[model samples]
Target chain A: MTIPIDVETKHRIVVVLLWLAALVALAVLAFIIAVVLWNGLPAVTLSFLLESPRDMGRAGGIFPMVVSTVAVTLLAVIVAAPLGVGTAIYLTEYTSETALTRVIRFGAECLAGVPSIIFGLFGFIFFVIQLGMGWSVLSGGLTLAVMILPTVMRTAEEAIRAVPESFREASFSTGASRWQTVTQVVLPSALPGIVTGVILGVGRGVGETAAVIFTAGSSLHIPTSIFSPARTMAVHFYILAREGISMRHAYGTAAVLVILILAINTAANWLMLRFQAKQG
Target chain B: MTVARREKAIERALLVSALSAVSMLALIAAFILIEGAPVMLRHGISSFLAGTRWAPTKGSFGILPMIVASVVVTLGAMVIAVPLGLSCAVFLAEIAPRRAANFLRPAIQLLAGIPSVVYGFVGILFLVPLIRENLGGPGLSVLAAVVILGVMVLPTLIGIAEDAIEAVPRTYKEGALALGCTHAQAIRRVILPAARGGIIAAVILAMGRAVGETMAVIMVIGNAAIIPCSVLDPARTLTSNIALEMGYAAGDHQKALFATGVVLFAFIMVLNSIATMRIVRGRR
Candidate 1:
């Protein structure tokens, strides 16, 4: 069974295989991004961005969908940011490592693992139906808030934990209360990380499709209030593509979505890099 | 107000906010169970789990086909992704220069951040047509789901595997290299075995992701509630079934969808816990 293979040849083969694997991964990412941009960019016009849809998304723009997407994302951030930051603060600053902390961490992991469709189901039943929010921006935003809660909390916790212990000790030595130390000293230092988490949450909210579909009714018109039903760009693209309604509009919507997500992700990455630099 | 009282109040408030996360998890589970369990109990758990048919209109709620489809798709995705991901991880951790890794790492993270819907869109536009033209079948088969999910899970698998591989002490490789082993030989003989636990953990986590993926799978899996005879055969997954039907399902049918969710939830939980355990063990 001991065939004498040349070590040089074997090393060369392994290196080639590793290069091929990396190339394949890179190729796939490139192809997908290129295809989306190629097919989508032409459809994205000023009119498409500014005007409302006409004739069930076949003839006009996606202004309403854009508005709805922003509204829902803003609402989700409003609801999730404070709660997530507070939870992170509690975990990092207030609480000792205990069974309760373990349970909470476990819960966050479980939440993170739950599928988007399940969240949609829960949101439809609980927020839209049980709470009488009906398929509206509020219901959709609330559902998204729950879905993104773990991401924000985990990131914020890491950020808060990354704050130097010496900083806290300095504050304590000044006889400042724990609350004051966190709010005035630690939070200011950790703000970049927290903002990065929120931006990432916004990215999720924007790109999310399944979870928002049922809870946020796919209304054609722009939503005027939180109670008003509306469609997000992702849901709009899904409906258009799935129903074979309008590929042009779908591509246009997809292009906008892709751009929005890329922008948010780039900003988040920049903030994270800056935060890391500051830490170093 | 006294500073001590104010500090206590703030601590309590923060504690309550933190506990809300736990409560939310409990609430989701409780509601899903309460809504889903009745139908299962009424229909007999065995019948619900083991039956082949899943016609909600006809009042049959068996999910065997969906379960099989889910497992098949997840396994197929893992089979395709793990090698590529692992090799990529190895290249990044062991072979590539630091400059290459610095450039490649963000690219991989960006891949992860691209929404699932975009993946689904790409699948419908490209993969489905390609499959239909070349491989036959309805194009939107488990093959399409596998391909899309395979790509979707790559960043996850690669990132975790890279971390695990990098976590292997530099001394291990140094020792092997000192013995005159080639870089590849040392990595194959020493580094891989040292990082096996973490790689397995990565695979398990990716499996959880593949099993739970919905929107993309729904777009490409054809949504047929039948056991697939081959990868090219159209079939429905548990997540897809719930999503495709929850819109119009009523009464028993709706309850059946929730029951499906319960199954999916349980599957994810088991995979997640196993992955978590492996990761914890690997860290130690």
Candidate 2:
């Protein structure tokens, strides 16, 4: 109903001002990106990112952190995928229209609205303290697992729902058990979206701060096992910058985090496209 | 057959197992409160609410100004971000070309992915300097937090508000147009009101983000534990307070941080409930 900013008359000045503000935003976004890219890329050459954080500071690079991030993220996905997919499958395919399903759907939606800090608090108590995981990678990963459950469940549900009822009908006609049809047919159809959710959730945890900081000790020691204290790159950046580290170093770290996020997003998009093409 | 009846029970069991994700939120809440309650009970109500000095080492347990700062900063962010984010949403959904809208959508997503620390870095690097240069005096004030928080919440608000605006029925727009109403008029009159519930929910959610935000606000707010007399003054926020001091806090000081978290939790619970209410009503 509204005119595009360009063509709208009688408000040229307003549009100009809006663009100016947007440009400023863009500029800020760009400068930070550039700083991170400029610093991290050269410093994080293949070996540095590939290497372990067993040596010294500033120069040691973030190998263990990177490994832990990947390891924990994978572990998280592993934990979330079955339960999330099962829940999603039940919601979209198996369950009949009912109050319970409706309530569950609403709960899943609101789960994303909970602040990450609160999740950190939960993780600190449940995984880190009560469970005696004690700031281990296992606790961090499991906490992230629960945090990402709703994401995976919702996306998996949508993807499963997109598999037409005909598929189920045909499988039933072919004498396939409900579980067989669901596991074999519905899962393959929904795999792409489920994978996307996993990717997105990993991206979220990788960038997370308030939640992971408390549960995952910000120790820079290279984790000997999943239970060892470790620092995520995001948390590293927070601690370093908070302690008044030089802007260049902070910018470099931020840049590394951004690049990783961008890379994750790109892969997810590619997966989406490939999946859509297959559907077509 | 007994076998078939057992199979039915098994199906019901599977259903129960799958739907247990719904309980996870309550579980999370309960777990946090359980860990946090001891500290809250020990500190009593007065010092947690009425005091202001936050030295964990000295055993000073005042959090009044930090609580106020959190509220003020969140309010400032909401004041600036809500309108701007709404306008951006309007621009995308109602104003922009399809191509531009599609392009901007992903850019907003990109914005969302950039870490909060990066935003903090940008606040320190760019926003602080810009505010300092133009506005004069000590840089990185509450205004800076507002500016950064406004921009940070832009993508989230825009994405949600766009959905709300887009959810406005096509028939309403057509009817408005048929009545000699301009496209802009239809949007301003019908679409906005129709989408009011969702917009409010989106705004509330963004407010939540602003309140919980630590790294970015901590980066720019200067972390002064004073009652900010104006938006131009530096102030400490609740999340920033925790992140700053939780490092070395021992005993009651650490407990105070937990109490602060309890306060923040109560704040978020209120916001989330409001958001949930609006969202539920809109669905109805």
Candidate 3:
């Protein structure tokens, strides 16, 4: 198995190849971000950020899209956070190693793997058509809530599991009930992790285009209520780019969307790192 | 209330909340089946799945082209993504300096967090034009989708592959080196063999993502209903077909779209289960 001196070249070549591959990966990332910002940043202006569309989304800004995106994302968070945390608590704290628990975990995994487009179909059928919610923020948000529940639950479960056993034992010895210890002690320690999950959920909700499109109803008007049809930034970008209406505005919308996603990701990673540091 | 009774009530509430995910899954499966089954029964599942032409307006609903397109695009994406992603993972886990790996990890994550729509936008702006001008046919071809999807799946592949490689016991590498094997040889022969299960799982997971991707494919795949003969040929996938036609589709046409979802759902479920099985087996 010994390598001859001649094999030094082979090793060197392999090393160089590895470096090149790594560089290619990084370059793709850099190239994408640069191209998006270069094409998109110049089109962004105060009016572009604030004004309503003048002619079929060709002349004006994406103010309404932005509003709808926020509305839907916030609503999704409001609905998903409690359910996800409760599920996580049930799994980590209340449940034992039982068949039902395994089934629940598998169900969550399956739900997580289900495609966004399928979620869109479900939302369209179950929420919009069956439930009579119609195409609105409520329908879109509920769909997203379902889509993100597993992510939140998994992350929160991990965070809860990471809580030290001694902490729980001490709480119990001090006459704290299970509910009291969880609500007063365990939850406080797990807040950062739960927050991380919520942030990730928000990021998914904001970036979601396919799932929201059918449920939300891509109207151009500014929605005055949750029931009013509205378009998200991602959907607006899709419509503009697909129809060849205005590449300028499409790029502009894409740039804003990219910036928002990147910001959320950075913030989430930072929070995760801080939590890890505190725990360590 | 007594302490035991209070605890029981709380546990029951949490258990109910936990079961909501299971209920949601059941409801989704039921609704998709309920809505789509009638069409499949009426049209005959064979014709619905095997017929080539998809003229919903004229009452002919065939998804053979779409199914083929989905497989072809996903395979093409895997062809491009797997090698590059594996190499990147190898570089990070075995070759790169610790500082470089740390920096690259976050960058890769940022890549993952970027929305699919943005990838599609970039594809339409840059990739599509490049393909159209140089490669012939419309810019929005399978090649455009392949390139974009390859990049889109990189983070997933790299993240999982890196974990697998890193999980290989240090003893394996040490033993290889002690036998006078070069670092590259050690990695290729010893570390990689050890991590093969996890790597395959990662690839399968990435395949699942590629198959399930909708918006990006819809944006760049030209939305043509015909089967593609080449990488440059524009074709529609099951996902894109459903997304494109669902909005205006009514009655049988709508039911057909739901059936398409059932097909897609089955594919994803199988892929995910296989990948999860591999990972679990690898762990043991």
Best by DockQ: 1
TM-score of each: 0.97, 0.90, 0.96
Considering chain A alone, what is the TM-score of candidate 3? 0.95
DockQ (Cα-based) for each candidate: 0.71, 0.43, 0.70
Instruction: Give the Å shift of residue B107 in candidate 3.
Output: 1.5
Q: Give me the runs in candidate 3 sitting further than 4 Å from their true place.
A: A1-5
Single out the weakest 10-residue window by summed lDDT for candidate 1 chain A.
Answer: A247-256
By how many angstroms RMSD does model 1 differ from the true structure?
1.6
Tens digits of per-residue lDDT for model 2 on A1-280?
Answer: 9765542453455455444544554565676677778765665566656665443344546677776677667777888877787788777767786999877876676667666776777787789878999987888888888888887887777778778788889998998777778877888887887788778887888887777788877777777788887788888777667777544445556767898998987777678767777777
| Residue range with the least summed lDDT across 10 consecutive positions in model 1 chain B | B102-111
Q: Please identify model 2 stretches exceeding 4 Å from their true place.
A: A1-31, A51-56, A246-248, A273-280, B1-20
In CAPRI terms, where does candidate 2 land? Answer: acceptable
What's the lDDT for candidate 2?
0.76
- How close to the true structure is residue A24 of candidate 2, measured as C-alpha lDDT? 51
Cα error, residue A177 of model 3, in Å, equals 1.9
* Residue A106 miss distance in model 3 (angstroms): 1.5
CAPRI-style grade of the A/B interface in model 3: medium
> Which run of 10 residues does model 3 chain B get worst, by summed lDDT?
B275-284
| Rank order (by lDDT, best first) | 1, 3, 2
Docking class of 1: medium
The models' CA-based lDDT, in order, is: 0.91, 0.76, 0.90
